[model samples]
Structure formats: C-alpha cells, structure tokens
Target: MKELYFRAMDAIHNACLFVAGAFLVIIVLIIPYGVFTRYVLNSAASWPEPLAILLMIVISFLSAVVCYREYLHIGVGVLPAFLHKPAKSFLGWILEMLMVATNLFMFIWGIKLCQTTWHQAIPEFPIITVGLAYLPIPIGGGLTVLFVIERFLTQKFFSEPEPETISQLTTE
Candidate 1:
C-alpha cells in the first residue's frame, strides 16, 4: 500500500517539476520576445505580458508543491536544532499539522475564488476565463495535502534510509 502511494507521489512530483520547468523556459523566451517587439519593432505585443503573468502564477504554485514534496521550501531550523529528541519530535508533529491546516485553507479558498471568477474573461486573452488562470492555486494546495499525508504515513510505517557521509560518497 505504502509503496503504491509513494510511486503515485513520485509521478505527481515529476509532473509538477516538468510543468514548472516548461513554464520557466516559456517565460524566459517570452520576456525577450516582448522586449524585442517593443524596442526593435516599435510595437508592444499585448498578449505577451498577460500571458507571462498567467504562466508565472502557474509556475509559482506548481513549483511550490514540488518544493514542499522535496523538503526544499525555506524553513527555520535553529529552534528545532536546540530542542531535545522528544521535544524535537513533538515540534515536528505540530509543524506538520500546521502545514496541513494551511494547505486545506488554501485549497478551500482557492476553489471559491475560482468559482467566483468563473464568468469573468481575461481582458487580454478573451478566450481564457479568469477562473482558469486561478486554477493552479487549488491544484497545488490539493497536491501538497496529498504529499503531506504521504510524509505522515511513511514516517509512521517505514524505516528511513541513512544519509550518506562524505567519505561514503567519495568511495562511490
């Protein structure tokens, strides 16, 4: 059961990473084109700016989910470092629960926001609804919730592998 869950999570993580990376590449290409069009051609393209903004939102949310899954998000560790083993354990539990609560709030409120804006169209891109632009928020929040559950389950049921030391890495 746990193996299946972990495999699913791995797939999700990779998908998020790929999406984020693709958007980043698009953004990189887009800004330069926007600049070139405005400066060299003396004509500013309207769609590029708005499109970049929308892509950025999606990239930010998806990247955030990937970061959380990989434990790459910024965290304050000084307080945890000072605590004893039992206290550290308790603190970790408290923090994880807090993260779960925060993600839940994001997911619930994001859906509401999307529904409220569902009828509104983007000014620059008439074909795309505002709701579609805001969809990444709830999606990311939901994915983070699943990842957090995976973390909880794996910690409870699985023995974590030991970290390799510098000497071990050097030998390999």
Candidate 2:
C-alpha cells in the first residue's frame, strides 16, 4: 500500500512540474505578444493580460506543490541548526504537522471561495467563471496534503526521507 502511494506521488509531482513549466512558458510567450500588439501595432490586446494573470496564479500554486515535495520551500535554519539530532527530528515532524494543518485550511476555505464566486465571470473571459481562475488554490492544497501523506508513509517505512538535492550531493 505504501509503495503504491509513493509511486502515485512521484507521478503527481512530475505532472505538477510539467503543468507549472508549461504555464510559465505560455506566460513568457504571450506577454511579449501583448507588448508587441500594444506598442508596435498601436492596439492593446484585452485577453493576454488577464489570461496571463490567471495562468500565473495557476503556475504559482502548482509550483508551490513542486517546491514542497522537493523540500525547496523556504525555512528558517538558525533554530534547527542549533538543535541536536533528535530534537531536530522532532521539530521537523512538528513543522510538517503545521504544513498539513495549513494546507487543510486552504483546501476547505478554497472550496467555499470557489463556490461563492462560481456565478461570476471575468469581463475578458465571459465563458470562464471567476471561480475557475481560483481553482488552483484548492487543487494545490489538496496535492500538498497528499504529498504530506506520502512523506509520513515514507518515514514509517524507510529510515528517513532526504530531499533529492541532498541525496544527490551526498552521492557525489
């Protein structure tokens, strides 16, 4: 069961990375197009800026999931550095529980937010609901919840779960 969960998490992490990267590429490509049309052609495009903003929201949320999974999210090192091994391990567990709690709040509230705004549509995108733009919040939060579960599972079965970068560094 744990192995299956770990495998699924690995796939989910990769998919999030790909989606975030694709959205970033789209933002990069379209911003210049918006600029060109505004400055060179003397007519500003209405859709590009709003679209880019929506894509950026998606990218930010999705990138956050990837960062959390990779252990690349920001952390205060000073306190942890002063602790002994066991204390540090306990602190790490405490921090992860906090992550779970925070993400749970995000997921619950995000759903309520989306439902509340579901009736509204963006002016530039009449077909897309305002809620759709905010969908990433819940999705990212839910995925992080799953990643946290994976981490807990991994820790139970394995000795420890090291960040990929650290493992690579130690190998070299």
List the global CA lDDT of all models.
Answer: 0.81, 0.82
**What are the per-model numbers of colliding residue pairs?**
0, 0
Predicted candidate 1 versus true structure: per-residue lDDT over 110-168, tens digit per residue? 99999999889998998999999999989988999998898787653112223431112
Clashing pairs in 2: none
Q: How much is the lDDT of residue 80 in candidate 2?
A: 74
Q: What is the lDDT of residue 165 in candidate 1?
A: 12
Residue runs of model 2 more than 4 Å from their true location after superposition = 156-172
**Model 2: per-residue Cα lDDT over 60-163, one tens digit each:** 99888876777667767788778888887788788789889999999999999999999899999999999888899899999999988887765521132355
Return the TM-score for candidate 1, rounded to 2 decimals.
Answer: 0.86
- Model 2 TM-score (2 dp): 0.87
